[model samples]
Target: MIVNLGDQLFMQLQLRGTIWTQTITNLRTNWAVNFSIDLLGQSQNYLYFRIEQYGSTFVDDAVYLNSKWKFARPSNQGCTLAFRGIKDFVSTPQLSADGLSCSVVKIIQRAKENPRPGF
Candidate 1:
């Protein structure tokens, strides 16, 4: 989900017999753009994502961050993402012994907009 500063997005996923929820928050006081994947209730052993700037106007100063789980079960978790000024535009998944895979089923983006009633 894409979120600007002061905004929060919540997502829930169900896997096996458990339901897990993830909440992402943009803590910057200024406008910040980011994308996140929540593998809350998933059993996947690995996850990865690649970011490409579609236009030349896209500046290299933009920063992106990501977090994920590294173990077969949720008990062993890991989080890593590129910081500002970093050159790596892709993230590699840290997999578990089971070597499972994950597919993105749904995505939701929330951006703050002027409040309007009954549009």
Candidate 2:
């Protein structure tokens, strides 16, 4: 789906298998921007970057953008999928294992509490 951020800026979101990605276009002329979030990761780890062009090469400053939109909240139990704006997640782990761990427990519990109708 495509979302309008304002003016001429728009974002494109996509989900495939285990990975979800969002690409922001018409924001800056010198950089290409996007982010990828893994719904099924221990760290609930995500990546956001604005690839800045330097002559002929692109560089990863590792900056990110956030949105009000969220996913898998039932599993988050109470964690979050909200605003985690710009940061070098490599040097700074984005989320806590404890926070993400709750999601796992919630998933298992939900499965037990609400079993599927059939195979």
Candidate 3:
């Protein structure tokens, strides 16, 4: 799929060793700097991302607890997975100015007491 800077997309992140994956929808254009991924998420000192675009597949980038960034080549199937150690931060999903990395912040989820129908 061809994705530009302003295109909104959905992201499904599956952390290693975890049986369940989190499905994030309406991720917005700020997070599509790379290709559409199926499983991508960060817990606390580790970052994981997969790149699936056109005929190319690769992990693309990995950030460790020390705030280090590394670029790896695509694997045989065009898909790659990486793991690293980094510092832990409050997890509030945030996009960086360059749209390359996600910042750390606390996330709070609340349900609407009253439901509103579409007009």
Tell me the whole-model lDDT of each prediction, alpha carbons only: 0.34, 0.36, 0.32
Which 10-residue span in candidate 2 carries the lowest summed lDDT?
103-112
Alpha-carbon lDDT of model 3: 0.32
- Report each candidate's C-alpha RMSD, comma-separated, in the order given: 13.0, 16.0, 18.3
User: What is candidate 2's CA lDDT for residue 32?
Assistant: 46
Off by over 4 Å in 3: 1-5, 10-18, 27-45, 54-119
Report the candidate with higher lDDT, 2 versus 3: 2
Error of 3 at 73 (Å): 31
- Writing each residue's lDDT as its tens digit, candidate 2 over 1-119 gives 23222323445667777687878676534244789988764434332323333353312222233322234433333343333323213121233344432211111111112121110
How high is the lDDT of residue 78 in model 2? 36
lDDT of 3 at 51: 28
lDDT of 1 by residue, 1-119 (tens): 44443344332233434444433334543333334455565565333332333453332222233333334443333323222122323335354445432222222121122111110
Q: Please, what is the TM-score per model? A: 0.28, 0.27, 0.22
Off by over 4 Å in 1: 1-17, 29-42, 50-57, 61-68, 73-119
User: Which pairs clash inside model 2?
Assistant: none
